[model samples]
Each structure stands twice: as C-alpha cells, then as structure tokens.
Target: MTAGLSRRAAICGIGQTEFSKESGRTELQLACECVKSALDDAGLSPADVDGLVTFTMDTTEEIDVVRNLGIGELSMFSRVPYGGGAAAGTVLQAAMAVATGVADVVVCYRAFNERSGMRFGGFASTLTSMPLFLSWYGPYGLLTPASWVALHARRYMETYGVTNADFAPIAVVDRKHAATNPDAWFHGRPITVEDHQASRWIVEPVLRLLDCCQESDGGVAIVVTSTERARDLRQVPAVIEAAAQGATFDGESMTSYYRDDLTGLQEMGAVARRLWSMSGLSPDDIQTAFLYDHFTPFVLMQLEELGFCGRGEAKEFATVENLSIGGRLPINTNGGLLGEAYIHGMNGITEGVRQVRGTSHNQVDAVEHVLVTSGTGVPTSGLILGRD
Candidate 1:
C-alpha cells in the first residue's frame, strides 16, 4: 500500500462560469474567469497560488493562464490526459501538491467550447489519422463514443437482462434534481421514465439522445490547500478524505473493448477500492453520489462497479428506491452531465463541494461524505469529499 499522505488537503474555494451549449467566449477567457472567481472565493489573490493542474486536452496552457491571469511564480504545474478522466485526477494532483508542501495553494481547472466551437459527438475523420491504436478501431466502425459504448451496453443487456426502461430512472432522478437547480442547464425541466423512453435513439438497444450528456461550453475550478489553513478561508472546507485515479488492465481509452469483462468498469473499480480503503468508508457511508453520467447505462454500471450494488443488480437497485432522493443513496443532486452542464466532469466536482458545504441547490440532509466520479468506460478517477 502506498501509505496515505499525512496532511489532509481541503477544497476551500469553488467557481465556475455559467454552464451552456454556447458561451461565445474563447477557452482562455473562460479559464481566466474561473481562476479569478476561485481565487476570490478563497479570499486570496492570484499571487497566493503556487501550483496549477489542468487537463492535457485543455487548449489553455499553464504559462498562458499564468500570464493572462497575472499570477505570480508557481512551484508545481502538471496536466493529466484522457479528457474527462482527468477531472478528479487534476484535483488529486493539486491536493497532493498542497499536502506535500510543494505548494501552499493550488488550483485545478478545465474550460472549453465543446458545443458551438467543436462538438465532440460529431464524428471526425481525424481520429483515424491520430495513432495506430485508434486507427485499428476507426476502420472497424467504432468511430463514435456511442458506438463504442453500445457494444458493452449490448453485452450488459444480454448478460443481465437489463433494458432501456431499467436505465430510465437514472435520467429521471437526475432531471428531477436539475429541475430545482437554477444553475443546471436543464433547470425547470424534469423528465419522467416515459420521457426517457420517448427520446430518440442515438444507438440501437443501448442509448437514446437524451440518455447521453450535453456538449457544454463552460469552465469550472476548485482550490486546494491544507485543511488546517482552509479553516480560515471564505467557505467551509470540503476535506479531501481520499482521491484516486485508476486504469485497469488492457485499458484502451474510451474503447476498452478488448477487456475480459465488458460489463464492468474495472478502471473505476480500481479507483473505488483505493478510495474506500484510504477513506476508511464504505458504500453505506456515502450520503450522495456524483457518478459520471455521460450515458445512462454507464451510470448503472458505475453503481455496480463502485460496489453500491452487486454486478447485474444495478437495474434492480435503481428500481428499488436505491437511487431516488429519499432512497438509500441519492445521486447527482446537481443533475449530473445528463441534466446539468457537462464540463467534462468538472461541474461534478463543484457539486461535491456544494454538498459538503450544505449549500447545494438540491442539498441532501446532513451530507458527510460525497463520492464524485469521473468519466466511465475509460481510465477514470474518483474523490471522497467530506465535512472537515
């Protein structure tokens, strides 16, 4: 076991630009805005920042952000790859930096114009030209995310007898939470199981258009510092009880089709094992879950992989009041990527902080520990946020 770090890191500040399909702004501008907001929220200035972490996919680089934001010297700077999988990993990097005294204050951020500028869902031929690994799958008609995930979803249905209706409750519950959250992209728009069933199919027997997340253009950021120092910050510190990133054997980005198990998120399973072991908490201790909802089926799969339910039991768990607000475990009170803006899971981390602060728009009563996960069907990451 890699012994846990001694000093606990806590998120003392959170900030984000409005979640939307079209922000009409440059990615750099969005990054600066969010960085400034987070700094202000932390009751600190740009000069106080000594570390920075962001996604490798992010267009805004560290030097550019530092110069643009008028930030001073930085002691540590790094980036994680694999798009949405880097969400919690960015925070993990920041927290590690702060905990080790390599930096006093660190910020993790992600910003993009994914919708109006460059829609990721729209298939592009460039993927075929990228690398040999992607080339192998591109020629096989596994060109789109939905198509790649469909294969696994089909296998899951075949093995578990799960159906489209079984995935409906995930969307229904997230939309219900979104309906009450003014910041949510789907605010005031609650859906029923009928709505999920009625939505147009994106992939046969696997997903519908509504079952997938939106292409949002915005930015979200979080500030990390030692829990002791965070006590004097502006907001109630959301302690980082544990943070972990995991990639399972034979991991292949979003298209991990070669894995021995098609129905499980082994990468996420690895993250869950480390998170629970380090945090000394179990599924029963989680007050709410912010599992990645890039697709509804993946949400069910995550419930199973994270040990919230047994394998092939997530559909039953969802139907048996395990996923509702008043049920055993509420999930995605921020509406998730399905009903909320999808900033590649950055928004999910912000929601985890809100729950810890007891200020979430869809606040769960007496939230102590919240589990926030990154993108599934890939090398993913997770965080256990708790009250300090």
Candidate 2:
C-alpha cells in the first residue's frame, strides 16, 4: 500500500528566473518573481497560497516574499538549513503541510544574488563565531568550499584508486547535456574529457574549474498541492513518491570528514534507505536521477550511496553514453548544476518535474520515476518524484 504522504502531494507547477552571474536585483525581488511565476503556472492567485518553505540561508524573509507577492495570510512557513543540502527539505516540508491539511497550496522557494551579492565561494575566515571544526581547520588554510570538499575528494580517490581520468567523464557528460540546454550557463559549449584534464586546478588532485558548479545568481520556486487538487491544475502532476532528510552520526555541515569511510556519502545513504522504503521503490525503479553535482566527486559517491551501483563502481558507472539522454538512467537532463544554473539544487527539483511531465528540453524516454538528491557529504535530503 502506498503511504499516506507518498502519493498525497504532487508538484503542480515550477518557475524560475534566468540564471546569471549577476542578477542586479535584491534577493526579495528574485524570490517574489519566481513565486509569482510558479503561482501563475499553477493557475493559482497569490491569495490562494497558504504555506511557504525556504532555506534558512536565504536572505529574503517569508513575510517579505509573501507580502511582495500579494500572498494571503499563511498557515504554514518553514526553513531548512545547511545551504544546498536543504534543497529537497523545502519540498518535503511543503508536502507534509499539504498532505496533512496543515495548509493548501504550499510554495517552496530559494533565491539569492549569490555571485554578485554574496559569493559563497569567496567567503573565507570566520567573520563571526566559527564552526568548532572550522576553527580547528580554518587556520590550516582550509577556507573556501572547494578546499573543504577537496579533503573528502582526495580521500575518496585514495580509497577507490580513482584517477583524474575517472572523474573526467562526469564533467564531459554534464557539459554535453548542457550544450543542448539553452538555459544552461555552459549551454552550447560541450567539453571533452581532455578539456576536463586540462582545466586549471581549483584544489589539487580532485577538483578543477570544470568540476565545480557555477556560482550562479537566480531563484527557483515550486508549487505543491494534494494529488487530487493537482489533477485540476494546468500541468501534469509530479507526485511526491517519497521525501526524506537524513544526517548520519557525527554529521557536520560540509566537512563531514570524521565519518568512517570517506569513499561514500553516509548521510545520502540514510536518505536513500528511507526514500526506497517510503516510496516502495528500489534503485531499479528510478529511470532518471538529478544527483547533486555541486562537485563532481560527490556525484559518483551519490550514485553508490543511493544504491544505483555498488561501492567502488561509481567511477565506472559514470559514463557519457550510460548517463546521456538515451542512457539507462539519464541524469541531470536539464544540464544539472554543472551545466544548468545552480539555484541551490531547487533547479534539479524543477528538472525532475519536467522529466515526469515529458516537457524537458532534454527529455528522457519513458521516465516514470525520477530520483533527486541534495548536497552530498553533508546533512542532506532526497526526493522520489514520479508521474501520477
């Protein structure tokens, strides 16, 4: 039997602003723009919305967005933490609200002028109070996000005997997909494995400029309602099969190096287990995946943790032909964060919906189940979305 929450909620609409390096607008403005578009897509007036979910790190407040968008009084509002890791949690929270009747017509959104306003990659030092772990590691020159993820990426390579060549295929395939996606920042500009090999190093031995996701500026918003109500909406419903958040023991934000094995993502493993159980679907059920690719190495690790492939096999499983539009499990069909714009993984959720709706520009054939994971190597979340 399907769980009450599993098929109760469906994504009725998705909207976003153009991805860019500099939006030249306030975070509030961007948030409002996306929410307005999402509501319009759902054929909902702002007054019809009663719930809101967003990232804790988002600069715009819930009230600010609601007021600006002319949304009526809200019965539910929530915020998820841990930067990109909170992506799926936003929808999960909204689904919960809609499923239990805590609210109807929930809007989940994330917005920022990350590149032009506050660059996360450019952030260094503990300006205020430091994270206890960062205080210990920060002085040792572990400052930027690239350097932080590099620690785990380096250890993963050593454990699995993965080389730069193994990592090149991921970038190559993502860029290939992006080349066909006009909205992707790197669209129309596919790269070769040789190109990935030649890119300048961001952090030695693992990440290169090509491996890192764009520091983009934009917003994405999703509309969630009961599957029953969704059927009355304008678009095909992307039912929420499962939604879960997980953090393993001793879990830190991004620098979760204290885990037993750096070769895989334990937090993502927890989410995968719950998602499979809650959705009554295994790895075999997923036709496409929107694995978070903020960094390339984690994408491989996510494949392993999510049970798409066994441990130590992700290096080989990540191939251009194997993961392309016609591949068995086409991934990041909207070009992912690497190719498309990075709206802190919210864009991935949108792409998942597109795949289910058969409206993606890089549409995968016969897509019934789409798996999407948030930031790996951190306290993360995952969602299983499928056609209703």
Q: For each candidate, what is the lDDT?
A: 0.88, 0.89
Colliding pairs, model 2: 179-188
Over 29-78, each residue of candidate 1 has an lDDT whose tens digit, in order, gives 99999988988988988889989999989999888889987889999999
CA lDDT of 90 in candidate 2? 92
**Ten residues in sequence with the least summed lDDT for candidate 1:** 123-132
lDDT of model 1 at residue 172? 89
Alpha-carbon RMSD, candidate 2: 1.5
Ten residues in sequence with the least summed lDDT for candidate 2 = 124-133
Best by lDDT: 2
RMSD of each: 1.6, 1.5
Clashes of each: 0, 1
TM-score of every candidate:
0.97, 0.97
